[model samples]
Target: MTRRGATRNGLTRRGVPAVLLDVLLVLVALADTWANVDLGQQPAVSCALLGSFALLLRRRLPLTTFLLTVPTAMVSDAVFATLAALYTLASLSRHRVLLACCALTYAIIDFLPWPWSTLRANELSGTHNVVHLIYAVATAAAPVFLGQLVQARRELSLRLTEITEAREHERLLTAQGVLARERAQLAREMHDVVSHQVSLIAVQAGALQVSSQDPEAKRGAAAIRRLSVQTLDELRHMVSVLRASGSRPTELTPQPSLADLQRLVDGSGMEAELKTDLPEGLSPPVQRAVYRTVQEALTNVRKHAPGATATVRLHHVNGRVEVTVTNTAPTRPPLPLPGAHHGLLGLRQRAELLGGTVTAGPTPDGGYELHLDLPREGAG
Candidate 1:
């Protein structure tokens, strides 16, 4: 491949017009022949023309054209074709450095003792020969230096382009990371403000209902307690959907369902019972809402009604699914702690979006109850 590339480049168009250089070489041949060749020596004239005209083929056949000029160059004063061919050969040919060294030596030897030059071998001083040698070496180095610069520039430009593309890719990935974190922050903020308040209300109402003596006051307290508890439950389900990692299918495996409620209770590290008269294969949306409703209700029970037993029930009645989760009265007040109640509003949004309704209030026996209704079709 390297050899092929060198061959291809040898034939490529030049910055200095190739045809004009060829003509200049030919003119040098004519000038030298007129000045030095005797009228009878037509053979010497023919050899000079052969060397100069060979420049037309220098690019197309760089090495071959250079060899063609060597014999003619040793005898004739005209050596432009020889010099031009050496330049192309050094620049575009394979083994460029090695070839340049060899050609430099050849140029000095070929030009130094040429028969047509003014200084003959017998009269040539050591100083004069050194000067001639320097001239030849300089001539050879010029073209080789120009070609090396062109190759260097081409390689540098290509490397710069690669670096630019890599930087753009890195920037794109960084921008995406920033955007994802910003979205997750928004989800967290909503949960903090809403979930904390609803959970707080539910816990307080339960205590108030148990403490109240008047029938009216007790009933009012029960209603408030149930609503708050149920609101808290709904929010958990809604927020869970958002909080699950949607970016990966593996992370989004099926959520807890009606059958899975027992498992949820067992793993909850709390005392709870689950009962269901509901059939299997509920639509995913309804199932998720139902599971979340029950899950959140039980969570609130654990949080506020310590030592309370939560009872979960599922019913399929009148083309609808009904889920009820209730807890016994708390033996002790809940721990006073800061909370993020952000999930309450999110729960309402979940039920409404799925065409379902959920409610929570105090039970008659100084406890709390949460109920949710979703239609058989698309959660009604």
Candidate 2:
């Protein structure tokens, strides 16, 4: 059972509230006192009463309470108060020597008669007195044994609860380890099978486009090559994301940086110009965000604004990096293309993570412009 459930069950088994239990013990002690001690014996009666009431302090000061009840046990026949105090002390205390001494003290006190100088030696030698002394020792040891058993049970329950929780945590970690391994295996398959085939398709398309005589055939081959290349790029990104799952943040394969920006623009198969005058030594995240923003903007322009020229500019100003991609009006209508439409949304999210922003809108001259601004420190 859960720890909370066990605690609730313990409370249910107890049945009586602590205050009521204390009151009940006090009443039992008082009844024992009245039955054992005579009213006329003033000193014995007073000690009996004091010990009976002292049961109320057993939970808080068990040793002191046990000591207080010793006087009554010695002077009168009343024993309920002393037994209760002894049991409480045994349950709460860990010192074997202390408990042993307390039990021995109780046994001696209960066995010896009052006014010890009167007839002690002769009485102790009698068979009846010897049996009575044995009975008193047995009674004292009873409570101590019972109290120690109760303490051991309580500790065992807590230890079981800790073991249960540790096993549950281990089970969760094992499940996650299995999932991470599966993802890694899937990533390797995609890279080896799907990416390799797409690369071959792009290469074949490039060869066909170069060798074709008909303009229409060449255009078709070029389109096929470009689309294949784009698909390969997307497949690589997806594989990287998959491999990164359940792991620490890592650099994506073919990790993009500002140095790759020129190659990206040149390979985009569009009339695009790149201009940058930014400082060196930018953080990786900042450079990556800039590269992805330019890549996405150039892709959109190629797909949606055919025959339009694009200008890419980047610079640093006021401790911030700024990037803008602007494209003129399309000379021909854009062809229908299938897209998940998450490119700009993803760019914005990446920018936000680096304390940056991405904004896109139409310019006054019937052109589209995309802008990205990032802090130089990159979310430090």
Candidate 3:
């Protein structure tokens, strides 16, 4: 047999196959009917048989099955089927009124004589009949109360399972949030510490290249400066990717500002000029956006437009800060370089986050221009 078939054959809830348990209950009901039913009474025998067999339908039609078995309890002493059916109904139904009515009907039917004509008013007042009636009522209530207890236990188990799953999901989300924050912290450190130190290296290399008299020393210094700039570019890309993983905002330390624009242009290795008449005390985010825009524009010019001279212009007018980076056409063929191609996209995203816009395109004269415009107060 397959594993599923074996499981069906095996013990279910309390070490008894569900199908076997049903069959055993049916056999017990049949036995009860045979023991109590009078074979000479055709109607009584028929009702006993009908009630015994109606147990099969209890799961699908609990109320109908219970009503079918009520005739057996009314006419004969066979009451196992009626009690079983009542229990099934109570377990499945949520209506207390309906269950109470069914239980009361069973109790009254079992208490009174089968033939209405034989039940005299004086017999109802007899001590033996009163005690028997109480016993019948208690018997009928037993199965109903037991069924309700089982139903309550089942509902409680389901509720507990749901609570457990919810807690596990919350724990997973908390762990993921912690991981994201750590990644953002690491990215910030790389940007503020590693990137800054590398930029200084590149600047020193450029200075050495200019002052050194030997041609070999100048070549070495230029190579160091070029490689350092490339490393800085890659680091910037990594930082952007890492920061994107975190949903919550975190403050980045040692933020670059407009004051760093002159130093950036001087260290870019290309002939670049910075012209700005902007006022001081601008928001840090606004200054950083403008600075990153200029940096990315200069990097792209070096990569794709070799020997190009660039100009950066920054100004604030009419409650808006506008930055424009224009570069002349290349003087020679540019070298093929490896890149993630995310620089311009990152700049545009940064501008958007700060309530700004970035637009870049090639000029009619074969030059390229990038423009960034931002609100004076940045995004609220």
Best by lDDT: 2
**Model 2 alpha-carbon miss at residue 35, Å:** 26
Q: Give me the displacement of residue 355 in model 1, in angstroms.
A: 38
lDDT of 2 by residue, 1-380 (tens): 44222234223236756666778999999999889999899999999999989988877688999999999999898999999999988887888899999999999988887767675567788789889999989999999998888778777877998999999999999998998899899899999999999999999999999999998678768977987988998888888887997878766667789999999888777789999998999998999999999999999998999888999999999999999999999989999999999999999999999999999999898789999999997986
Look at candidate 3 and give me any clashing residue pairs: none
Stretches of model 2 off by over 4 angstroms after superposition? 1-161, 177-185, 188-193, 196-200, 214-254
Candidate with top TM-score is: 2
lDDT of 3 by residue, 1-380 (tens): 33211223355546777667668778999999889988899999899889888887776688999999999999999999999999988887888999999999999998989787787888888789889999989999999999898778767876999999999999999998998899889999999999999999999999999999998689769977987987898889788878878555534446789988998888787789999988999998899888999999998998889888999999999999999999999998999889999998999899999999999999999999999999998999
List TM-score per model, in order: 0.38, 0.59, 0.55
lDDT comparison, 2 vs 3, better candidate: 2
How many angstroms is residue 376 displaced in model 2 relative to the true structure, after the best TM-score fit? 0.6
Instruction: Give the alpha-carbon lDDT of every model.
Output: 0.72, 0.88, 0.88
Model 3 lDDT on a 0 to 1 scale: 0.88
lDDT comparison, 1 vs 2, better candidate: 2
Question: Arrange candidates by TM-score, highest first: which order?
Answer: 2, 3, 1
